[model samples]
Target: MDDNLKKLIPFALKYKPNIIWNVVFNVLYALFSSLGFVMIIPVMNVLFGEEEKVTKLPTYNGIWELKTYLNDTLYYYVNYLTEQKGAAYALYLIISIIIIIFLLKNLFGFLGLQHLMKLKTGVLRDFREKMYAKIVDLPVSYYSEKRKGDVMARILGDVNEVQNSFFAVLELIVKEPLTIIITLGIMFSISWKLTLFVFIFIPISGLIISKIGKSLKSQSARAQQENGYMISVVEETLTGLKVVKGYNAETYFKNLFTASVNRLYILTNKIGKKHNLASPMSEFLGIATIAVLLIYGGTLVLQDGSLSGGAFIGYIGMAYNILTPAKAISKASYQVKNGSAAAERVFEIIETPNVIRDTEKSIAINSFNDKIQLKNITFSYDGEQNVLKNFSLDIPKGKTVALVGQSGSGKSTIANLLMRFYDVENGTITLNGTNIKDIQLFALREQLGLVTQDSIMFNGSIADNVRIGKLNATDEDVIAALKIANAYEFVQHLPDGINTNIGDGGGKLSGGQKQRISIARAVLKNPPIMVLDEATSALDTESERLVQDALEKMMQNRTSVVIAHRLSTIQKADVIVVMNRGEIAEQGTHDELLAKNGTYAKLVSLQSFES
Candidate 1:
């Protein structure tokens, strides 16, 4: 509880101005409500013929003297009206005062709610936006170990719960205390004895409420984690629905989803039961307090006639007011427990160290020159084993290099490292004599283009998809890029041409057409460097040939790094690097490698039979 409270203080402090306004309105509302209860005294005295004539009104001489003086002045005015216009006019004045207090109470209540909502929603928006930015800015290695849906759930669902439930607790922070204080003050003025009794039971109720909420934090955390798992299931199913159907794994996935949801159901029920206990238990305690107050106050009145009927009734009213805020405080205790679990999850992502960040004084390069050098580079996805060890490579300003290797042999790792997707653990990778780490990532990436085997496309028009590579590219430039990538012919034949809307992930397009569009996108980028990672491996022969032609044209006069499984594809490469178990086993042109009769030779022989 202390830890959760500590976490909330920072978020609360972030929106202090809104919190201050909310607190101001809440305090004012509570004060007005209690004052309305106190006003009943003078009006009732006039009605019952127990009115006292006063030459001088009440006065105060110590701490809280101003508050006491105000209460006295209010009572005196009511007395004056009672004397001037009889009991009926005083009754009307009391009714009018009650109406005014009620109005002010509701008005301030609305203002408090408005400010609370503003702060709640504002924090929610900012938190989500910052989380999203962090997610985008984070190194790719982070996502390799994390579920996409889990991240999504944290950003959307869990964050929302924190905003709603956490701020709901905060609303009580101001309202409940103010209500308890004002009501206690009024009750004490009426009869200090009864107010003291009320205070005694409050701690006992608080202790019980706190005990009930003890397990709520762990339960809420489990619920949020299960929610992430459920979302992951949904995301996986959507992304791989075709594979699921093709492999006849629908029932298996359905059962998995059902089990996850069932666990979520059980956890939700647990959380709900814990949350629901707050209202009823608090209500029961309140009833017990009220019953005790009645017995004690009744004994006092019956024994000595010390407590007046009006005063006793008003005191009970104040006690009743205490119940609402007390219940709220208890409920907020539960809510804060729940929100604390979510806040921890949310803050974890927001506070994750950005392992990849630009140097403070890094300068941006306008163009690539000289050569890209990888000198004695070593890297590892996990710290235990190196994926690339003592690796060295150099590509001149305007040449093509193809890296071919078996699975997990550091083919794709080269592409990843070259793009600075993950920084190397040891040694230097430099472009034009400048270390890649020392350059601004955006500027460095802007100078390079990547096209992977799995072509990615959003749901948008062809023109929009192409323009994504370079936002400022003109329509003419897009069309020219499409032509260069051999995509314009099919695109022009579509019913809407460039305006045709591709479905999600380009589901509307054939695999071959998607590859063409991807090539078109790369061509549109016109970056000085291009990285092609088995870009044509997924295509049919005809499509591969067309895309290869487009790629060749795009590669012209550019520093290109190619990863290919087909040895025939890199037959014309200026350099071919064949990796075996994180180290280069063979290097040279296709013929030179085949003549070596080594790993590259065996790979070419195996692929020749498969092709």
Candidate 2:
């Protein structure tokens, strides 16, 4: 077995009970199927009147001669019935028995398929759930380097491929092989010489099938990758549709999307050709083997008379039966190959070690106290070019600290590090004297509320969106929080008030309305610490005033770190720290900072002129 297959064993073992029942059904089906073919021999004997005329009924025999005794008894009864009643009745009875055997065969086949379906769907659900959990648990930085559409393809398309291929593997490993074995056994009983001839061609067909499967995995892997790229193009196009149209770059994007799809089209065509080749090659080989059997078996029956005509014909029926299973196995080989590639992609995500995780000795933080202190922290999103170089700051409890800097000056990095969104390369960020790394991740996050420039909203009711901050918040609590954020009046005027469905990302509301909703979410959480990254930068004058008022109310008596692009928003901050090129240039109250005539004063002057 390949390593990818080995990794999937546990998931397969999860459905062991169903698989065991599937095997039992398959065994029963194969038995009935072989019996259905064996019944042909008796029909041939009756039609040719070749059955022996019995003088007396066969006596009971020991187990060694049981086969002989059973055959003799069956022939004696048929002969007696033909003489006493009619040959038509005997023929009718034989045909009815064949029909019953065939019905049982098909019935067991359906039962086995049902078991397989249960296992397949269950494993798919488990696999997808595992991947989704891992994706959610990974650090925010992981997504910075990955495309959303690519991740989506892995979670959706790759998982679907794995499901199909894995089911093929199950069929190949259990049902098809069992059918071939049972059918071969019956064929051997009819004539071992012809069965030996069949074996000679078996290895040849297997070699050809194995060669076909080898190329499919690599091609399948390429196709899947290309599919991810194509999906990413579509995702980017939708996300940037306004820009695409505003810049008149539609043709450029369309051409790029078309190129990606064309590559995928070519790759999939190759995969399909290789994958579809298995069935025909195996079928042809099977037919060639059957042709050989005809000449060899015909010579035996005509010249030597060692094998009877009826037995020869029954052997041919069993021989042809092997072809169906052979074809299925051949097809399954390609599916397993394709599935193996998909397994590698899926397990790669599942087995990835989360770079950010709480340690065994991590402490749980029940409440915020004292302050959050970032002491001489050095960090980077990538390995090179530090975003924060030996940066240090102190945010005391119940004090509003504003971070003012140009873009890329590491203002937001401080908030991310405090929240443990990314760990520092050096130094420690402590909450109330305990290192944030040493604190439980969820527990630490529970103590802080975040509101970014872009108000992130789900396609849910206004109340539900606010309740995300506190899962069990009551309607009264939601209303109170909305009032605190100054969002109550607008929310009340909406069609369903708090119950109205906010279209994707609250697109139905104005910019100010969405920002207030976010503030309401933070207020509902009622965390001791809050981080507002440019909470009102994108708003018009009116919207900014409303959102700024909500922020001021939310920040009252709460330990807050506010990163401000517009200096007017932070004029009343208890302490304003101006950063320059990844290092703090100055820190003081707004009026006190103006006395220094330094970086803080220059930024305030530029923003005042722009306004």
Best by lDDT: 2
- What lDDT does model 1 reach? 0.85
RMSD of each: 2.4, 1.8
lDDT of 2 by residue, 163-191 (tens): 88877877888888888998897788678
Candidate 2 — what's its lDDT? 0.88
- Among all windows of 10 consecutive residues in model 1, the one with the lowest summed lDDT is 1-10
Q: Give the lDDT of residue 564 in candidate 1.
A: 92
Cα lDDT listed for each candidate: 0.85, 0.88
Q: Model 1: what TM-score?
A: 0.94
Q: Which runs in model 2 stand beyond 4 Å of their true positions? A: 52-66, 609-611
Candidate 1, 25-134: lDDT as tens digits: 99998899888777776666666665555536877777668766765676677678777886688788788988898899999999999988888878777777878999
